[model samples]
Target chain A: MNRLQNLFANKKSNLLSIYFTAGYPELNTTLDIAEALEQAGADFLEIGFPYSDPVADGPTIQQSSEKALENGMTLNVLFEQLQQLRERVNIPVLLMGYINPIVQYGIERFCKKAAEVGVDGVIVPDLPIYEYEKLYADTFKQNNLSNIFLVTPNTSEERIRKIDGLSNSFIYLLSSSSITGSTLNVSTSIEDYYKRIKGMELNNPTIIGFGISNNASYTKACEYANGAIVGSAFVKHLAMDDYLKNIPEFINNIRPRS
Target chain B: MKYGVDEHGYYGDFGGAYIPEMLYPNIEALRAQYLKVLNDDDFKAEFDQLLKDYVGRPSPLYHAKRYSEKYGANIFFKREDLNHTGSHKINNAIGQILLAERLGKKRIIAETGAGQHGVATATVCALKGLECVVYMGEIDMARQAPNVARMKMLGATVVPATSGSKTLKDATNEALRDWIGNPEDTHYIIGSAVGPYPYPEMVAKFQSIISFEAKKQLLEQTGSELPQYVLACVGGGSNAIGMFYNFLDDESVKLIAVEAAGKGVETGHSAATTSLGKEGVLHGTRTILMQTEDGQVVEPYSISAGLDYPGIGPQHAHLFKVNRAEYVSATDDEALNAGLLACQLEGIIPAIESAHALAHLEKMAFKPGDNVVICLSGRGDKDLDTYIKHFGY
Candidate 1:
């Protein structure tokens, strides 16, 4: 079984997931960040591979991607950095990025590399469900790597069911039909949409992402889904001067107080 | 031959909405409402009226007698240059603005290369009283200062994209990012028959009026509604697609798409998409684009900023693949000379992009009385500096 499946099986609710850009802040900071995030009690970590164009990202994440590229981050460098990652961090790690850079890197090679690096899954927002089904699903399945699909409020029940069928790890329930990093208030419509998805009882689990900032939003999101993944907000902390020391504090702020 | 967009939004193998999930709702809403809104009687009436009154449509299809005498073929110029914003870009702009209004969108965002699309979009937004934001590459804004001023004068905020090559592709990336961020209450009026699904089909249908009017005007001027050959320059291929849409069914008509070969096709500065391109997704659609082995988009070059784009529209890619249209290219020197010849012989100065199609005429062995229609897609007013620089005024 995949590490993602094991993690989800063990944790039923409020599973905290944190997303931070790989090669961000510094070129060699990914391992440190991952170790720090694991120590901070994050259940899962989404390591972003920066691309020149990230359509789904907002200013904060986009800036991180730019900085990562300027810092001479590439697929080879990232893969090399992750060579001994499993030795330090045991939590499930998923690589999140746009499809173009991966496509450039060769999809098969990317999947193989992810598996070799102990990555459990990937979140490519731009790769449509149809594309993955036709071209990459077999490779992912063969490599024992899961690929997460995102759903918006506008996704029809039929498409949602289809996406749920395709997704192995979880369906990323976007809080709203907007990009990441926006200050979002969970409106009644959002709550209603979440309820609708929960009612569907999809085959795979669900995790909410996008516009999830701070403890309140994260807690509110957990009421409706398996858990929540905080990206920009967590990434914002990583950009701070004392990110290594601050990671645990930030995670504790989002996670329930022990 | 089925040439229209399929239900899946594909033009054979080329088109599909490959946007991020964040943009799914916006594109989905657009896909759902575009056809219904287009078919609405009121929508048709207003679109037609705007084309007639504001855009000065039913633009004359003039017989270039001097050009015909010189080239040994009866050439007709579909005067898209006579439109209000000085190109066929205005046709789609007016259509999209009206559609955006009908969709209850409060703000409009667009990306431009040479700034003709920006000017056209800004003009429509000004007329409709919509808040407009236009993303343009820093380099393009500098090169096309006049059109940039025109966009600003029409109350559109022109944001410079400083990333990447600082060209059309980068500007489009910035605009897509903006759209993703502000998905609600903002409609992206893509300037060409490119990007995702509904955009390529929508812009093509809107600009189809160019050929729609040309067919009637050609029948009135000459006895045949179908010309032997129809030629237009391809950048993102909006003007060419607009000129070719109506004639796709006519198997007898030979369609020629001329791409910009900046220095030359082999000089690494050309924008000849079909000649030196591969199938890939760029700006949301799977199209033929100049790309590296690593799939990083190659920066294309041309004297005409409008033709400096690295990719062609997905529909154009489909057409080229299936051999429905012949794709050719012309160099900068050749195009400048052709622009000069058109000015001297036809009393009309064409935009440098349009001159590429005119330059292709020099290579063809046209038979006597061969009825050829060339889409004079834009006027040279905005390209005056480039023309002056080349010809020394």
Candidate 2:
């Protein structure tokens, strides 16, 4: 069975996916955080590859990523961390980043290492669906890494259906108008969009991302998709000095349908 | 012909849909609707009528006899600057504004580089009686004070994008956020062919009338339609695409796309696409964009506000791939000198945007027997501030 079908087949309510930049608290600490989250009741984890200027990201993630970059993070180091963390973690891990480093690292090599390191999917914001299929889609499929794609509110119905049909399995549904960490209350946008898209009747299930934080936003996101992914807020939570100790409490705070 | 970004919207090796989930419905809506309107005969009739009456189509193909005689080269300038609102931006704006009306969108938004497209969008919104908002860079709003006032005068609100480098890219981001919020009532009229699928293709079709006109005018004047070289400046590369569209299949024609090498390529102050950019996704579609190592958008520099971009249209990259068109760059000093010389020699003040094309004449040899037509994209009156700032006599 596909990941989404398996994830939703059992009626365990909507699963919550937490995202935090790897090695964010300090260098060589990614494994501690991953183990903490997995044990603390997280269903999925997203690992961010720090870029110099993340245009789509808001302040919190920008800060964590900058700190990660300053701590001397590179693809080689990220791969090393992932290789180490896979030995310990059991939840499905996804790698999220921009396109430059992967292209520089060579896409096929990146996918091969990702599959070896227990990565289930990959999300590169700058890789267009058409280019993804033409360039990296086959390589990712070859390595058994699902290439997850995003669909914003501005996407037309025809395009949504096209991309939904083209996507390997699941879709990354963005919950807000702006980037992550934006304080914009997008409740109306969310409500209106859910209705608009429910009509398209796409077969692929979705997981919401961006602007999802705390109990309320997470609960609201779960109303539409099979799950919701939190990046900036969780990343900020993990930036704390005692994040490992607080991981169980953090997961408890964001657990859906609590 | 790489045939990338074809009717299907794939730019050969680049250009495709890479968007967030929230935007999926909107993309699908436009994708389904774009083909209907773009192909419909009634829609074509209305679009063509507006092109003729509202935008003043068949814009003059003037022979620059005096300038040609002085340079000893046959010169012709496609007078897109003569269009209503004094630029080629109206061609696309009119088509899109009409499309927005068809979509029943009540509010219109646009992103501007040199404020030309902003002005054009605001003008069309006023005529259509829809609420209009323009997003311009803070730096651009200050430099383009007159266009700002023109937008305000036309009953449109001007919002300055202060984030990032406060340039065209930032302004586009602001406009995009606004669209996401009010997708039902709002329509984003992107000024360039740099956005995601269908947009680059749609904008190119509207602007392609330039090449169609030149083909007819060149045939009438020289008893032949083909030119040795058809040239235009590359600021998001709209005008060059317009001039190159009808001639794409004409193998005898030589197309030259010139970009602003605002100081020089080495100094990191150039918008010269093929010279410095790599294939990547930017502003939505995969195209050649100048970016830093970490995939972060870097600050782009240019003396001319219009050409101050880090990327070019995907089709230009496709042109480079197939070797049908040659790309060139003009430094800041070279373009300004060319802008000044055109005014003094031909009694014509070319927009700084067009001056990049003029600089190409100095670099490339235009034989006396070779036919050369350059698109005078817009008028220089909008660039008086730039001229005075450089040459205060």
Count backbone clashes in candidate 2: 32
Once fitted onto the true fold, the runs of candidate 2 whose alpha carbons sit more than 4 angstroms away are A1-14, A21-36, A50-77, A80-83, A87-90, A99-101, A125-134, A149-211, A216-227, A235-248, A256-258, B1-7, B39-42
How accurate locally, in lDDT, is each candidate?
0.90, 0.80
- Number of the predicted model whose TM-score against the real structure is largest: 1
Native contact fraction (fnat) of model 2: 0.37
Candidate 1 per-residue lDDT, tens place, B89-207, comes to 99999999999999999999999999999999999999999999999999988888888888889999999998777889889988988887787789999999999999999999998
Estimated TM-score per prediction?
0.92, 0.87
Taking the true A–B contacts (Cα pairs closer than 8 Å), what share appears in each candidate? 0.56, 0.37
DockQ of 1: 0.51
Q: What is the C-alpha lDDT profile of model 2 across B1-393, one tens digit per residue? A: 535456557767666665544444566578779878878898899988988898888998888887678666778999998899988999999989988888888999999978999999999998889999999989889888999999999999999987567888888877866665666788889888777777888788889999999999999998899988899998788898999999988878889999888899889777776787777667766678786554555667888899988778878778887788888889888888889988888888889889989888877765686788999999899988778889984
lDDT of 2 at A145: 80
Q: Cα deviation of B252 in candidate 1 (Å)? A: 3.5
Q: What DockQ does each candidate score versus the true complex, computed on alpha carbons? A: 0.51, 0.35
Residue-level lDDT for B231 in candidate 2: 93
In order, the B-chain TM-scores come to 0.99, 0.96
